[model samples]
Target chain A: MVEKDVIVNSDAGIHARPAMMIVREAMKYPCEVMLIKDSVEADAKSIMSVLGLAIISGSKLTIRAHGEGETELVDFLINLIEKDFRV
Target chain B: MRKLTVRYFIEGEGRIDLQLRLYAGEGGLDKEIKYGEINRPGLALAGFFDYFAYDRIQIFGQGETAFMNQLSYEQKMKTYSDFFSYDLLCCIFTHDYVPDKLFLEFAEKKNVPIFLSKRGTTRFITLFVHVIDEIFAEQVTLHATLVDVFGVGVLLTGKSGVGKSETALELIERGHRLVADDMVIVKKIDESLLMGAGSEILKHHIEIRGIGIVNVREIFGIRSVRNRKRIEMVILLEEWDSAKEYDRLGLDDKKYSILDIEVPYITVPVRPGRNIPVIIETAALNQRLKKIGINSARELDEKIKKWIMTEGQK
Candidate 1:
């Protein structure tokens, strides 16, 4: 698994909109991924639990990926978050 | 391959038998029955309160409808809607399910076999037409390769020179019946079942390196080449590779998804000395064992784990 930490910066604070975007990206990559926040692990591809976290700005979230194309998936997610999750 | 069939019961007058294969309906048994012919049968108008037995009947709509043509389409249809007293009726959705008055009446008379689908006109016709045929299809199971190993039907697959033909030849020699050779045309009658047929181009024929293409039926006779077989398992043969690490423990149950359905896949690495036919038979048996809730590989793994646990305790 490739793990990386990113701080939530979007105004929505990783709510439904951003969670759905992450789910869409995760599905495109053939890898098992989980998003961890404050010791709680939520399936990154699931929009419901991700929204449950209610991650506010500056909350550091660790994204871990495993399986085929896990490294590339980490790079892609990193790029997506670094760019402030534009889409 | 065993072809699955569906039968639909329809309500019509003089028991105007119309065979229709059932597709899903819109609501409950209370939906309108839309048939190709609008003309209502006499019994539909008279109501089944006096004398009726079977739930529905099957008719050949594509054939001559001598009785149906005698009365006006609207008049015959009225026999069901205006005259018949039943709330629901069986309907034969031949080719279409649009809102038509005559069709609705007949459906109201019979209480079962209501047809409903969101499919357009042409698709409904093609599907229903086949359904009718299936209900009346001649009952005959053709010859085919049938092996009861591991409880799953394992169909060997490979391109020419990939050794499907050679593997099958060896399998038959080992006392297994040949289902189909060269081309296995699979058909999805429903979920959970898939059947295969040999293509006409290479039916019962196997090509060996020196012997060229030879007809298994001609050489092995009728007792050898089977006409069809139910495919419960699939074994794909690929050219052997020293670099490719094959699954040895039988854990992980590698799955090869075909036509949206996942089947347990065992890729046999092909080489000159490898006895693929024997290996594939074992794989088919293993899959069957798994289906019946007995996983030998998992059981062995558990046994090993228990041994390790005992050693640690000591």
Candidate 2:
């Protein structure tokens, strides 16, 4: 599994807009996307799972994936966050 | 401390076809050279003969003299066995001729995947190696978007056309950096730290309303486009809804999770002329303030309640 952790820089956390965007992106790939924080794991595409996180700014989160060119996809997301959610 | 050994990481699914036990001895490819960068013909041929003496050798390559040579064949079937290797995997064959029957027989004996690609180059193969490195490295990525607002990493995400680019562009104009554009890549270096960057195709390119695509590096120079950053915040853009109850006070927290990490987020509704860029900027700045343990929204709410109580007493 390829994984990267990023702090939730936005004040809103993974709410409607961000959640939808992430879910939309996650659905495009033929792999498993998991959002993990602390010891809890959630599916990247689910609205309820995202909302359940209650992530605040500075809260660290991990995105893990497997299968079908997952390395590239995982890298793409990691860069996005490393750039501080700029993309 | 013998750290040098062949290590195989099995992924997907597969089984060893034949019960093949490899051996190294005097007669075969073993007597050639010590296991290392066997680029020298002496070393390679040494390895070749040593292995070949045991069974047939399947040397894969492009046609580079240093690797595989078939042009030497028409005259005589050189002292070698079969040769094969994909263009994308390995190349540089010495000749263009096919291997002899002995070599073919060995390949048939050992069912190896013989693939050939006419396209791609050495650089492409290098990329394949890089990816394999990442896999072996076991690096993980988080689903996220990173934009710079006042030098702060603010990951913007939302449905298509929710104004992420517009806000990022606006923030850029306000003297903030643009980390990644549409997508972001996050890699975990350790248990606590995270690194991020932009995709090769979309790096430094942000699309605006009238402008189709503008290169941030070309226009704003390199400083505006960062290679990576530790994601500090996530700002989500959403369409303004009259029925929806938005976060009036910034006390309520939201988070976008990735790669087993929890990233904080802020939801900003888009409607009319509310300055989203400014709000995002303030959000980032506010996050910075919160880092120091100063909650502006909470403090303001507290002041308002105090004032209301005092006014009632008056």
Best model number under TM-score: 1
Candidate 2 residue-pair clash tally: 89
Off by over 4 Å in 2: A1-87, B1-145, B303-314
Fnat per candidate: 0.00, 0.00
Model 2 residue A60 CA deviation (Å) reads 33
Task: Give candidate 1's error at residue B166 in angstroms.
Answer: 0.5
The alpha-carbon lDDT assigned to residue B293 of candidate 1 equals: 98
Q: What DockQ does candidate 1 have relative to the true complex?
A: 0.01
Candidate 1, residues B1-314, lDDT tens digits: the string is 22221221333322213333444332334333343223323443344345432233322132212344455766566543543344333444443343244444344334334454445444655655565443333332211233333335666654334766667788777766676654345555445556565544446665455675567778877776666566776677889889989888888877765555576777788998888877877777777678889999899999989999998689
By DockQ, the best candidate is 2
Q: Would you list the C-alpha lDDT of every candidate in the order shown?
A: 0.57, 0.56
